[model samples]
Target: MALAVTCSISISSSSSSSSTFQSSQPKFSQIASIRVSEIPHGGGVNASQRRSFVKPPQRSRDSIAPLAATIVASDVAETEQDNYQQLAVDLENASPLQIMDAALEKFGIHIAIAFSGAEDVALIEYARLTGRPFRVFSLDTGRLNPETYRFFDEVEKHYGIHIEYMFPYAVEVQGLVRSKGLLSFYEDGHQECCRVRKVRPLRRALKGLRAWITGQRKDQSPGTRSEVPVVQVDPVFEGVDGGVGSLVKWNPVANVKGHDIWSFLRTMNVPVNSLHSKGYISIGCEPCTRAVLPGQHEREGRWWWEDAKAKECGLHKGNVKQDAEAELNGNGVANTNGTATVADIFNTQNVVSLSRTGIENLTKLENRKEPWLVVLYAPWCPYCQAMEESYVDLADRLAESGVKVGKFRADGEQKEFAKRELGLGSFPTIMFFPKHSSRPIKYPSENRDVDSLMAFVNALR
Candidate 1:
């Protein structure tokens, strides 16, 4: 939260070029880091009139994002860039989203907006403030859960950043789905399905691009073990533009964290996917997604049935060099690069399946309150166990102060309900449901002290 202050400063100056000033105003330490603004010269601080120096926060005004606002794609411009040079691309993780950013910076080209993870948001924000034109794009492989979409909306609205969507070709995807059903990828080798539904359109989406970035952290998967070069040669682009002839394949976040992303996002007011609160370390296609237990690998929740320690797609082909076409595919893809798009994530075409958390979920805690505070804890959590005392105390205080309350435990029998309903290890965590908030405050009392917890709760309250 921004703490705005009006401090009094006494200024005295001679009419000539030489000017001198003195002040009896006490310098509050809090204002030390704040930026200062001079009011219009004419009405500048009179001799004794206290100055309402609108001290700017220590950080850039854009450093902290505002509460989420509804995001409309139209809010984005079709093509926008002032100039592009001295572009710096960081691909610590080869995540596909990060791929979008590298390309923009490398080519001195401005994309829709640079797509980034929480780890990269600060730098991305820095670039935005510096007026670097970048485009951010994400390919929602039809399998994502609702949380991912909500996060997308949150990021766009919170930061006034636009994330462009890449959709699969409408015709081919329909034909494939109509013939094979939504789980067609499973019947066919996951590779073939990914190639047809995901890779193909993905390549097409990058056709006119100068560069494409990925969040492929080498430590996360085998396919991304290569050094996080600022550029790479894309296998798909045999003869495409700069991709085929230049360093197209890039991974900026190749060395970045699965955890730091959240910290970065939170710091930047980047709204995260609600599922993060539900113990989801990594989010992908919903049908293929499940909750990961403690100690499980981050990507394990995705493709749980695969049972393979390695996480990859046909694009990487299990990190194998040689391409095995029809013989390797359990199903069929007329060509590689599956036709998937952002719509698949949004389920914009309204694909129906038993794969969702369902309508009953939509009703949970709906109409509960304008600022319904839902707490997620674990029964075994010493912090939570002790919090029971603080919870009661905080609840009483909040009730007296006219605030609503609700709570859930991660280890409770109602866990699944809470998991699906509340979102898990995003923990000791407090959430405002239905209208997921980007900056839902975590309880501050690590000591579980009643006074500390109460202060934390009521302050956010």
Candidate 2:
């Protein structure tokens, strides 16, 4: 059976060592090279200190495991429901170290810490103190800051552990870039980019593990993450066994405050990203993250361009009621209750609604010897709504030109056609299909005005 285990850790002044193993124990030469006193205290390594370390050699794409190779079969017995409940109760108020110890002992090599930012490195420190064989991995989104990649190398060397780097599928990434361009997320949303870059790679990484750990805290985003439990079954991800109920997710620092994590990092001398010293709190892809002002929350630095409520990137959104597909589609349309109906889109003037059959009929347009303009849009999209007046005006003005203008509301029944066949990654995507051509030319101008739309089609003719 597939099971997803999620647990939280509280911050408390407890014993630092989760095991009898001492940091002074010299097993690996790399670990012995740095003395405990050499690590700076109270904060992360300053800019000068960080630059002192030599950069590690970079690995090639062939050296990293493919997504399919990461899925390992599992034979671990499932934890009884009652026992699992007790485990949660026991760790509810436990210190981060204690929580880490329990997880490391139970899952052993089958569990890994999903290391990314400073908080995750703190978890790495805690895992090191446990003295047991543990695993660490990072999702290489291929768009991360150079400093972040250097930091990953630093952590691996500092902790004397091998960190498996997971990457997104090359084909999916190429397809997204070829169709939408490299920076389409700026126009639409970050969800699609994140899905191709982070979420899918994480899914592949988790496929081989019975449990994984994160550094999520309830206090990070009070609006979205306030209810994070100290320990519970993960409702979203499956485990290494490939069964429906076998994987466990551990958020050891779920109850730990941000300051407390920094303190742990400082006290333990964990390696951290240099960007942290520059004021970036919550780090993701380089393009999406920024340094926040003194009063702003850490999460504010991530995806700051979008609405505050829509900050998540889908990794932690499995249980949330938000429309996963719409978010990934980057249509800027929320699938809340009472969403706009098909009539709302069809009622507009100069707009022809296209159904599945209607889309199929478009092939006949190739024979009609008439260039046509079409928009794949979602009715609830604010951008699509804003373009309505201009679009209608453009259609009416172009009627005498013998160029057909139409739109497809990519919602409900027609979503599949828009997404799969048309490759509609974002809403209000205007395309001009020339007569006798199956390939449609995308609207080239960023300015969504009637004149601009007319100029595009007129130039084509």
Candidate 3:
């Protein structure tokens, strides 16, 4: 439960920035100047001390330039960074209700739960259980299912709380539709469409708040969300503060399982999306979601046409950690010369790093002593990163054999050439160079696990 203490913290704002909330509600400019503080953890301060901590200096006429807004934001982030990190550590194993309590306590009404109109309704339930004042918000992508829209209304009626709806800019949506049909995502990829409809609107919504809670669970997507922490500084989107590390993200149910979430909802008699009963395990926009078959993982229903390893809709880019791909020249400094440094995974002894010239020479197959197996990959690609461990293990197992295991960096300047000749339609394209034929055979399956890759190598060799 939230501590019984009250104070005030002021959020910085601009004159023209409009409220994402309903028109009947006051504009952001009106409400942004003052917020009630619900005691943060062990700390309790009267209204004066609270003002000293978070309330920015008073600006005349409620008009601050963008540059001034940025400075104010930077100060707030620096002041709260260490405290939030410690808070995250302390709440590592805390229950969803407890974490939600802490979030509500710190940010108060300045924080809002990002309700996804799906299973994320559990977050609202947790907040209600905490008996704390909370705000709820959702992105209206204009493409959600009719059932999901109805469920949104049902949630509003059940909770008696208004949901602030964020929408994409009209011109942007029109531009995308004019250039390409509504279903362009089906032909190319979902990222562009999702960026315009969901990610941008969510970004706009978050920019008006100090913190936001999410429904992310570690078990939701093995490739992307497995390491979700209970609390952390958001790595992707900025908040009202508007800078890197300026936003605090709470994943109260990060440690919880999907089955457990459903159980809690059932036990509490919480309302759920009607689509859940129809087997839509992970519901999203109408076109992107579907009913899964028995025993299939929930996320398999989302973006089913794309690689499962890269299923995120870009709302939580922070969850996709790419630190392993950081380029450093042994001393964390870039090489003075024009050469790009390769990551350690590409430099392993068992897996030879093949340059474009080396790959071209191998294609000749003249006086070749051993067959070569190589993966054309880009380090930045999530699918490529996902299979790195398995690929390295397969290379280690093949080290004794005469076959040469190698990797060719096929992105950046080399991407077009790779597509033309090396069958590089996507990241981490695997090809086998046989002993006799110059033609390189492509690995046909999406299964990139160690056992499956080893079997493919063994059969080909």
Candidate number achieving the greatest lDDT relative to the actual structure: 3
Clashes of 2: 14
What candidate 1 gets wrong by more than 4 Å, as runs, is 1-105, 110-131, 222-230, 238-243, 307-310, 315-461
Give me the overall lDDT of model 2. Answer: 0.65
Full ranking by lDDT: 3, 2, 1
Model number with the top TM-score: 3
Write the number of the candidate with greater lDDT, choosing between 1 and 2.
Answer: 2
Q: Is candidate 1 or candidate 3 better by lDDT?
A: 3
1-461 per-residue lDDT for model 3 (tens digits)? 11222221112121121222221333222121112132244354332112122543222221111122323432442243234555666777777877877777666555788888999999988877665557788888999999999999988767766677778888999999999989999889899999999888787767666678999999888657878888777888766645666567889999999999999989988778999999887888999988875324577678877654458899988776555545433222233353554353555789999999999889877556889999997664445666788888889999999989999987656778788988777656899998878888899876777888888988998
For the record, the alpha-carbon RMSD of candidate 3 to the native fold, in angstroms, is 10.8
TM-score of each model, in listed order: 0.44, 0.55, 0.60
Candidate 2 residues lying further than 4 Å off, grouped into runs, are: 1-86, 319-461
Candidate 2 lDDT by residue in tens digits, 195-248:
999888887777666678887888777546766765555557655445444566
Residue by residue across 1-461, what tens digits does model 1's lDDT show? 22222211111111111111112223322211111111112333322212111221121112111110221234322332211111122232234333333344334331223242223444344334333344456666665667677767765655554465665667877887788888865544455556665667555555544345555554454222433343454445421123233224455455555566556567656445677678766556677666665434455565554423224564444243344552322111122453311111111112122112432343343453444455665433323333455556555566644455555433324446545644543335555433334334444333444466555555564
Q: After superposition, how far is residue 89 of candidate 2 from its true place, in Å?
A: 3.1
Q: What lDDT does each candidate get?
A: 0.42, 0.65, 0.71
Score residue 25 of candidate 3 by CA lDDT. Answer: 32
